[model samples]
Target: MVGCDDQMERLLEDLTQYSGSSRERKFIRIIGMRGIGKTTLAKKVYNKADIRSHFDFRAWAIASSQHNVKKILISLLRSPKGDTFYIEDEADLADMVQKSLKGKRYLIVLDDIWSTKAWDDMRLCFSSENNGSRILLTTYNSEVACSVGTENLSL
Candidate 1:
């Protein structure tokens, strides 16, 4: 770890281990109550890491208590993911996001999700044939993480 802060140090370690060694496509939820630094920690790892160059592409989606699938897909497709840019409809956006992710390893941050459906709808986009992609999901619900999979890159 490169910081004097112990919490930051621990976060650094966890991010390094997960991104470097975890081969399977993963969903990590930083579960905590409000103001517990879940988003802060995930942001630190996202901003101050060498993982970007390690992966083929990096994208971020800002989820809310109420979110539409097209909005999320549009945001995730903004980065260099090789996906066609059409987000007027939910089906079109989802298909483009999935098609663009083929053969590429991606690091996607699904921040501030509130339900399992968010993961369910978007899981197909991250589940690549190559199997080297990763999705970092930050939420306040443990059940959301567990519902997706127990094997998570949790904060």
Candidate 2:
């Protein structure tokens, strides 16, 4: 955690702020080259005691290079609740995710996203109803970070 205190504090401030007046959902992206500590920083924030108490639901998923929408949704869904059944259809899976996250304040960490398409595909499942929900991700590509349309921190 050396040299990461500042970054962690900044991210924590942004994440824990009140967004009650904003209609849009908040997203935080941590971008950096390989071997940097983007994932570590995200985990540190994700596991924080304040963060855990702030959000009603919390989920963590690894996007890696190959992004599987179903698997990601399943992981997200399972985090707040327990295990969920396997659904064959993509739409059904997405609908399930949306339903699960619908009125709850959630913090989802998407680690190692490799592409904008992956983010776009998964973003549909999260409903932005001015509920102060947040999606935080770590990525190697700056383009991917920018495409998320929110504050991005470079490590």
TM-score of each: 0.79, 0.93
User: Best TM-score goes to which candidate?
Assistant: 2
List per-prediction Cα lDDT, in the order shown.
0.71, 0.87
Report lDDT (Cα) of residue 80, candidate 2. 66
Q: Worst 10-residue stretch by lDDT in candidate 2?
A: 16-25
Measured on C-alpha atoms, candidate 1 has an lDDT of 0.71
Q: Worst 10-residue stretch by lDDT in candidate 1?
A: 11-20
* TM-score, cand. 1 vs. native: 0.79
Residues 1-155 of candidate 2: C-alpha lDDT, one tens digit per residue:
89989999999987878755674578989999998999989989999999999988899989989999888888887876688776888889889888888898888899999999999999888888887888999999988988997787888
